[model samples]
Target: MNWGPPRTAHVTMTFDPEGLTRTQREGDACVACHKKWPRPRTRIGRLPDGTALFACPECADALLPQQDDTRSRPQRVAFF
Candidate 1:
C-alpha cells in the first residue's frame, strides 16, 4: 500500500474570492471556520488575485494533511 503523503497542493491552493466573506478576504477571519478571535495565522492558500488564505490550527489540520506527525516520527516495532 501507498502510505505516502497526501497529493493535494494545500498551501498553494487558489481560492475563489467570491465565495469568501469580507473578513476572510481581509484576513480578519479563518478561511475554514470563520473564527475572528486568536486570528488564524497558518497560510493555507491564496485568492485568484494573490490574497493569502488563513485558517486556525484546528481547521488547518482538517483541511490539510500533517507531515511532521506521520513522516518524522519513527514507527515502533513489536517483539515476540
Candidate 2:
C-alpha cells in the first residue's frame, strides 16, 4: 500500500502494545488512504523520542506551530 500525499487531520497517537505486537508479527498496517495514493506509502511518523504522529502530510503541515500565542495567555489582573 502507498500513500502519496497526506490529506487527513492531525491527531496525536499513543503506541498501543497490541498494535505494536501485531505490526511486529506482520508488518506495517495498511492505511485507509493507501488506495487513494499509490506512492510514498503514507505511514506514521515518529518523533525523536518515538512518539507517533498519526496524521496526513497536509494535516501535519496545518498542525505546525503558529506565530500567535496570545490566545494561550493567562488573564491579566488589574492593579489598584
Quote model 1's TM-score.
0.69
User: For candidate 1, lDDT tens digit of each residue in 28-75?
Assistant: 899989999998887788898988778887887887766654557676
Which candidate number would show the highest TM-score if scored against the true structure?
A: 1
lDDT of 2 by residue, 1-80 (tens): 53444442234333344344333222233222222232222334544455443433543355433344466767788995
Clashes (candidate 2): 3
lDDT, candidates in the order shown: 0.79, 0.38
Q: Give per-residue lDDT, candidate 1, residue 17.
A: 91
- Model 2 TM-score on a 0 to 1 scale: 0.24
TM-scores for all candidates: the values are: 0.69, 0.24
Q: Give the Cα error of residue 11 in candidate 1, in Å.
A: 3.8
Which stretches of candidate 1 lie above 4 Å from their native place?
A: 1-10, 68-80
Q: Least accurate stretch of 10 residues (summed lDDT) in model 1?
A: 2-11
